[model samples]
Target: MMERVHVLVVAAGRGSRAGEGLPKQYRVLAGRPVLARTLEAFVDRDDVAGVATVIHADDRALYDGAAAGLAGRDRLAAPVTGGATRQDSVRAGLDALAARGAEPDDIVLIHDGARPFAMAELVARAIAAAARFGAAVPGCAVFDTVKAVDASGRITGTPDRSGLRAVQTPQSFRFGLIREAHGRAVAEGRHDLTDDAAVAEFAGHAVTVFEGDPANTKITTSSDLQAAELRLQTALLDVRTGQGFDVHSFVEGDHVWLGGVKIPHTRKLSGHSDADVVLHALTDALLATIGDGDIGSHFPPSDMQWKGASSDRFLRHAVERVRARGGVIANINATIVCEAPRIGPHREAMQKRIAEIAGIGPDRVGITAGTSERMGFTGREEGIVAWGLATVRLPVTAD
Candidate 1:
């Protein structure tokens, strides 16, 4: 069996350098907390078996609110309280994992919770390198001339730029090796080490260097946070809109399901699924925006397994497809066209349900209703129809 890969996110810093008030890790970046994005980088992957976050004892409420909407938050171990220093924080995380039954041979990646842009490819490289060598860290070659300056503000020496590489986490190691190294440091009272790789090196472990992405920059100041926001906007340059329309004939039933809500009605919509016209239209709209065909192409009526299935499943699938393509649902506007069933009472419920399924805030979803002026099928009170418009933001290359 392959050894499990665990991640320890160190976020216990005071972050005084970033700014006043909230800590940098809890700061909003590209619509979410930096720590939440960093956690997603590890927890979203199948190769990672578990995740542990080390947090400041005073920031429990902040961490909880920031990480409330994370997709796989249940996979995270109960957060442990960090210590006075970065090294101490890492040791606390390691100890937490050990208490939770992490094996000695399991791979541990110690990451900075402030760096939210660590890509999956970079993580894979670190894992591969750590498996080959007992310890490894991600590094990028220096492109600018480097100078070592003294406290007097004079250049002490100009180092060879070609030989220097700027390193970034997550620093990977065998669990036993890093734990022992940290223990040794504690015993010897060596608490000044900056990174985990340095601690491993101090313990006489040969640390290998792997390729690191320049985009995986750490947020240390207000300017760094602004730059990260700008970078995210630049990457998500491709925005597209898609419209979907779905109709279902009325059948004999006391209640109708619409947008995952059950409403008392004289007749219900009929279809292979739960016949939620609102959700069906929203699902197709999301899929169309991502160029992933329509809802029928994914959950065809010909498939018996989907018979009487809740339409929320279809909507959830469409949302996941958008995420897989590095896209986000910027806004969702759905309208229900019906004559008999009044939708005003259930509009808020519908919006909340759609927002939950799409992994976005309820404010981003809009729900409205209309009548067909007593002309067509909906006007004749024989069926209901729904139309949805979806705006999606995707990475430019994803187009």
Candidate 2:
């Protein structure tokens, strides 16, 4: 049987040095909270069995605000309240997992909530190293010279940098070993152990070292946060704009759906589903931005399951697709072409509904209405048409 991999993120620190009113983990980074991005890094991975966080006792509200929309993820466990020190916080997290029946052979990774840039490669290496060595820590080799100073700040000894390494987390260990190590530390009143690896080493365990990624830097100050934001912005420089147009004929009905809103009309639009032209066009536009197939390909007209289905489902699925790719919908501009129903009265409601479905702000959704100037099929009042343009920002990839 495979050993399950679980992640424990330590986020209970007050982080007063970050210079933000909120804790460093809760601070906004690239339009998302630092803790949210950190949690997603683990939750989105298929190899990770589960993820739990240790939060400050008073920061429950802050943690919730940062972890908005992630609480529903299947792999995310309820957060545990931390004690006074970092060691205490990790212990609390481990205890929570044990209470949930974690096996002794399972692997647990102790990660810093401030480090959000640990790539999948690093995670795989950590898991492999822990499985092979029982207790493993990641570290990067130091290049600069090192010195030991006395209390008065005088250099006492010059150390060789070639033998030095700066350690990093996701320090991985067998669940039972680390739990027993932490328990021993608690019994011995050794609360000053800085990290999980130290706890293991203090308990006479031989800890192995694995390579750590330099990009997985911790956010300790305002400057680090700024650099991380800039890095993320640079990585998401692939901006794309997609256009989609949809038309549906008028049929015999008293109401029509547009942009997920039901409006009273003399004739409703005819399609397999509630023919929401605006939402359909917007969905296609979003899918186009990601190069995914069109609405018909995803939800085919031949599929009876989607018969009379609400178009909001389509738009919501598109939004989730974008999110899955780490893409952001910058804005959605859609033009509604119709002669009847006076779209002007329902424009605000339409924008709000579309925004709600797209998981963006109403201000980011632009709704424009126009007539076909009595020339085309829309001009003949036979059908309603919608054209949508979606702007998206995605991380640049080799593909």
TM-score of every candidate: 0.78, 0.78
- What C-alpha lDDT, on a 0 to 100 scale, does residue 298 get in candidate 1? 99
Clashes of 2: 0
**Which residue ranges in model 1 land beyond 4 Å of their true spot?**
1-3, 11-17, 20-40, 43-46, 51-89, 143-163, 184-193, 201-204, 248-275, 301-311, 339-353, 373-384, 397-399
Candidate 2 off by > 4 Å: 57-72, 244-282, 301-316, 323-326, 332-389, 397-399
For model 1, the local distance difference test gives: 0.88
Pairs clashing in candidate 2? none
Please give the clash total of every predicted structure, in order.
Answer: 0, 0
Model 1 over residues 197-279: C-alpha lDDT tens digits? 98998888899888999989999999999999898888888999999999999999999998889999988889999999999
Determine which window of 10 residues in candidate 2 has minimal summed lDDT.
64-73
Over the stretch 90-192, how does candidate 2's per-residue lDDT look in tens digits?
Answer: 9999999999878889999999999988888999999999899999999999988888999999999998888788999899999999999999999999999
